[model samples]
Target: MNREKTYGIGELARDFDVTTRTIRFYEEAGLLSPAREGQQRVYTDADRVKLKLILRGKRLGFSLSESRDLIEMYDPESGNSRQLNALLSKIQERREQLNEQMREIELMQVELEEAEKRCLDAFDR
Candidate 1:
């Protein structure tokens, strides 16, 4: 009669492949609201889902504040068209930044290849 999935902070970190400090930071950010089992922090499945979303948002190049706003807007209890529009604008901005970075990376790749070829030619001299 004790099968409720409540993970300790260490277990949660291992399960999520993140640091305990990361979980703590999310807690500090109000993204995770874990309960305390004595001196230990125990995370619920809902907290885990929020962590997953936060990490995914980070991977997608979202700032913490922007990601938080997006998630807050996405909540059924708090969903608003205006907030959705703000999130969409953030997505668009991220896409544009990514496009610019990709262009710079391509240019760097070409330059590196050219430099490598020149070095190889010098070795042949």
Candidate 2:
């Protein structure tokens, strides 16, 4: 009999380098649904995969809702084309936002440099 490997909350937390509270928070947010074995939560491989994806999304600046939407869009039946397309769109949007922020930061840095120069010149006088 092939038994699927299960993970305890602590095991997942350790593997993901996240706190147990963070895992619980993801559960509360409906991002992960681990089964309860008496008092212990048992996570399946699917849950682990979801947790990994959630963390990856967070690192990529995706909001929880956006990640949730992307996760929900997964459908292996139709070759997952729709999900791939949606993810690509989201990636493009995030890239555009980051570019705009970079531009704004460059402007702010120039302004700060000018302000510092003026202060230094005033001090020199």
Candidate 3:
């Protein structure tokens, strides 16, 4: 008989380049459920995958709640159409928000440059 592979919290943290506290925070947020082995936390592969998805969602500008919702939408036994559609809608919304922010930043940059030019002209005068 073969035993399934499990990971320690430290091992997962190191592999994922995150602190143990971050993993603990995720657990507190109900994103992960690691089994307690005495004083240690042991994570299964499913937990690892969920952590990976959570991290990916964060990197893509997803809020923790949004990420949780997306994760919960996964139905592996049936299919992933619902999850995929929901994720796509979220991605679109994020892109729209980012685009608006980018526009605002560019406008600010132009205003700053104009102000700097005015300051330089005043100094030259």
What local distance difference test score does each model get? 0.85, 0.96, 0.96
Residue-level lDDT tens digits of model 2 in 9-115: 99999999999999999999999999998999999999999999999999999999999999998899999999899999999999999999999999999999999
- In terms of TM-score, which candidate is stronger, 2 or 3? 2
Superposed by TM-score, candidate 1 places the C-alpha of residue 41 at a distance from the truth, in angstroms, of 1.4
User: What is residue 79's positional error in candidate 2, in angstroms?
Assistant: 1.2
Taking the tens digit of each residue's C-alpha lDDT, what string does model 3 give over 43-123?
999999999999999999999999999999989876888999999999999999999999999999999999999999999
Please tell me which predicted candidate would have the highest TM-score against the true structure. Answer: 2
Question: Candidate 1: misplaced stretches above 4 Å?
Answer: 1-5, 77-84, 113-125
Instruction: Give the TM-score of each candidate.
Output: 0.73, 0.98, 0.95
Give me the overall lDDT of model 2: 0.96
Better of 1 and 2 by TM-score: 2
Global lDDT for candidate 3? 0.96
Can you write out model 1's per-residue Cα lDDT over 4-112, one digit (the tens) per residue? 6877888888988999999899899888889987888888877777788899889988888877877676656655777778867988999999999999999999999
